[model samples]
Target: MNSIGDNCTELKKKYDSCFNQWFSERFLKGDTDDSVCAPLFKIYQQCVKDAMKVQHIEFKEIEGDVLGSDKEQKVPPKSGSSSS
Candidate 1:
């Protein structure tokens, strides 16, 4: 998949390929250490962060949990429902 920043696509691809190789060859084999792709990931991450800054996207916005899974959500009672 292409990266959010076009300039980082190559870096992202490198990291993805490395991760895939590591996951299949090492992780699945019980060698769970993932530092093999850490450098590539860091480079790609920085590139994406730079692109986001250029586009005026705040880091806090991306940091938000859109799924709301961390907090309990109360469902409102349905209309016409009454306590017995």
Candidate 2:
């Protein structure tokens, strides 16, 4: 049982180490119409929670009112925008 726990911890570390590049690759792709990105996002969220658990970090609820809740939902604009 101890060994399994240690292995899981190490794997989580490796996952974290490679996450930046993996995230960039996934996020940089254009229009993933095959609908694969959602699962990757979920896995990334779970991995973050797992790592936080391993590190004994406490989470707090967010306090801000949700932004643009009344607007019709659409994909967020890319980083460079021309809107003035």
Candidate 3:
């Protein structure tokens, strides 16, 4: 795998290990601040998005369904152009 793949994998692990667990615990504890939580959750979501974006992919998690939409969003390389 390339460096981008490695970074994406690491971030995905962090989201699964830390972010998701924290959100679950917080919501269960009845901390209902949708104002703050929504954006934070979105950031966590964007983290997942970003990590996937790193791997030249996109995904959306809507109402318990994870779907891969047709390549509307493009993931450009962090640097440089691809040689033919």
User: Whole-model Cα lDDT per candidate?
Assistant: 0.88, 0.53, 0.54
| Candidate 3 per-residue C-alpha lDDT over 33-70 given as tens digits, one digit per residue, 9 for 90 to 100 | 43544444455566656666766664543233334656
Residue pairs clashing in model 1 are none
lDDT for 73 in candidate 3 is: 60
Q: Top lDDT: which candidate number?
A: 1
Question: lDDT by residue for model 1 over 1-79, one digit each (tens)?
Answer: 7888889999988998999999999999999899989988889899999999999998987775656574546688999
What C-alpha RMSD separates each model from the true structure? Answer: 3.9, 12.8, 13.7
> Candidate 1: worst 10 consecutive residues by lDDT?
64-73
Q: Rank the candidates by TM-score, best first.
A: 1, 3, 2
TM-score of each: 0.77, 0.32, 0.32
